[model samples]
Target: MALIPKETELQEGLTTIFEDLLLKKEGVKKELIRTRKDFNIACDQHIKSGFQSEQDWVNANASHQNKFIEYEMYCHIIDIITDFKDIHGQFPEYMEMHRTLSQIMIKLAQDEKYELAAIAKLWVDRIESTIQEHSYC
Candidate 1:
């Protein structure tokens, strides 16, 4: 039988991945081009290995790239959140802030100004798909 991921497992996995990426934010930004290219290749390999079909792999790769960008953006936002918490000694109402940030992400994706948008979009799609598919089983 195929192993199906639970919703909690998916959420935990995504959170862990993003947090790890956040930890690498400075390294990634300092070496943007090289790091981004390396990240893309790694994502490609991961998707290729996971999906049985070539088209599915392509789709997943695209989605993973988008999510990578989105996570990068989120990392920056996290810095701001950290500052806010430092000042107030409490977390902000993050949901509203996240909504606004998501709008910015969509705009970035629409404008096609950065490859990060594609990566972020791809990331979200794959995670969502994985969660849904696993939950159904």
Candidate 2:
């Protein structure tokens, strides 16, 4: 029988995306489990803080021209997820999270929160492609 995989790979990918622009300058991956309201509150706070802590306020504010979060980070974040399974072995739990994340992205996009969804889309697409590629392996 083929071995089912663990979630370590998927978990790592999701964590990287969370840290980029969650409205909270500092947060953990598990925070994603919170309600949408809580997630946005955190994202708003992080964006308002200018993506850095108070200690580096001046430099950070000046370095970033975007007053609101943008989808640019999605590119790099997606790239990392694409390499995830390779770094952490494949597992069934990993697949489920990939699917769930895609669903979350859809909801976020429908709500017009495209910045984060843009990243999710790439991750989801990558996951689908990977699943297909490995289906017969």
Candidate 3:
């Protein structure tokens, strides 16, 4: 017979995972803010000078795009966490979160955002490994 983890153990594990995710979310948010500011500054400078160097525009645009994607990804994560909490009154099961992450990974890949997709894949792998570690079979 497989030994099941106690409710408290599961809760503790979930708490740790949630905390880590939240921390990452905060970091993403900070980067989003900074990138937004940089993008705006770049635009303002272009408008004021009536010209922007090609390299400067490219750098600012790339940073804006990357941070926007990251912000969207973090928003999805927040939505998943919120919905799970609202429905279950607790942190989500690892597999449940994995399912959502898998969908995100596929969507990102479809969008040709391979780097973001890879990050999502890493999250999926981490959750699966957590599930495996907790399983007793």
Candidate 4:
């Protein structure tokens, strides 16, 4: 006999999604902290007041590119995170699903059809909830 649908499965999936989001939130917070520390270190090493050491090099005829490279690097990182947020619609479930879809594919290949179907339905529900949650965005 086929397994009948269960609301419990979606509830479990949502619980898992919530935990994953909390973990991701912590990770992003840690990354921000690390970036701030690195910025402070760079400021101490290269910046004198409002001017950078590289400007001194320029004054002395040194051929350094200055903080142009550093500026570009920061922009690159911001672009990457911005792109991630844009594509994921600010929902951690999008990232959670991205990470899990490969495993879901593998399970489907192994003939775990019921499990795959349940997960797909769970994902759809999560997506709907996310749309509703972020309707103002």
Candidate 5:
């Protein structure tokens, strides 16, 4: 569907020349239409990703180069906390995070990212405590 701009303050600034280019040049008009199509495609894909919130998008893109320890840690932590709040308890997700962090902790500790390693270790400890306190029946 062609988008017809309604009369508004921005329409008042259309300034004639811009409209002429769009009206007279088929290529310019086609490109403008393509932009809208591209935008809709992007929105559809973003919706399909099961994106929960802005934080989920941020964490998904936070990895740098080939290193992913920090972003992985952040995602796992958020998952645990969000699940805890939503369910009034927890699940095995934290145990999986503990395993992943344990594998990376050594490398992180040896590098400048030791602080993050420490945080992951602390997260593991928290998961352990949660499991112990809230034993499964």
Candidate 6:
């Protein structure tokens, strides 16, 4: 027979996961900031060059945008994972967690918490997109 994990065990496990994800998020955030700074410097250089090197600015802008997306995705994943751990005190199957989040989004909307509801909707959309993308693989 399989033994159930204790609450403390679950909490400890979640905490470990949270810490790891937080580290990754911080790394992404740093990269995002660095890319933004590079983009800004490129912009200044492009201006100084009388708009001669458009490619440099364009590449910097693309890098910054990619890093920003990565940072945002990490933030969303961390928030949703923390929420799941706080509510259920255990790791949830992805689909179950997604469904629960969807219900939460609806409840938040019904309660007139529009900002939070919108955030939840965004999380749900992210998760749905991830699932769809992985299903093809």
Cα RMSD, each candidate: 14.3, 12.4, 3.8, 15.2, 24.6, 8.9
By TM-score, is 3 or 4 better? 3
Ordering by lDDT: 3, 6, 1, 2, 5, 4
Q: Write the per-residue lDDT of candidate 5 for residues 1-137, one digit (tens) a residue.
A: 97543322222222232233234344434544555455555556567876544454443344221134444455554544444332423232545544655666676788867767786676556545544544443
- Model 3 stretches with alpha carbons more than 4 Å out: 1-7, 48-52, 86-89
Clashing residue pairs, backbone N/CA/C < 3 A, model 3: none
lDDT of each: 0.54, 0.51, 0.73, 0.45, 0.47, 0.72
Cα distance off (Å), candidate 2, residue 116: 1.7
Over 4 Å off in model 1, which ranges?
1-5, 32-74, 77-104
Ranking by TM-score: 3, 6, 2, 1, 4, 5
Top candidate by lDDT: 3
Poorest 10 consecutive residues by lDDT, candidate 6:
5-14
Identify the runs in model 4 with alpha carbons over 4 angstroms from their true place: 1-5, 48-50, 53-137
Tell me how many clashing residue pairs each candidate has: 11, 9, 0, 0, 0, 0
The TM-score of candidate 4 is 0.36
Predicted structure 6: lDDT: 0.72
- Report the Cα lDDT for residue 117, model 1: 59
TM-scores of the models, in the given order?
0.38, 0.39, 0.76, 0.36, 0.32, 0.60
lDDT of 1 by residue, 1-137 (tens): 97554644644544554455466575556555554565567667767787445664466556556556655675755564354332434323333434444565587878875665554554445444544544545
For this target, which candidate reaches the highest TM-score against the unseen true structure? 3
Per-residue error (Å), model 6, residue 59: 0.2
Clash pairs detected, candidate 6: none
Error in Å for residue 26 of model 6: 0.8
Clashing pairs in 2: 5-90, 5-91, 5-92, 6-91, 22-43, 23-42, 23-43, 23-46, 24-42
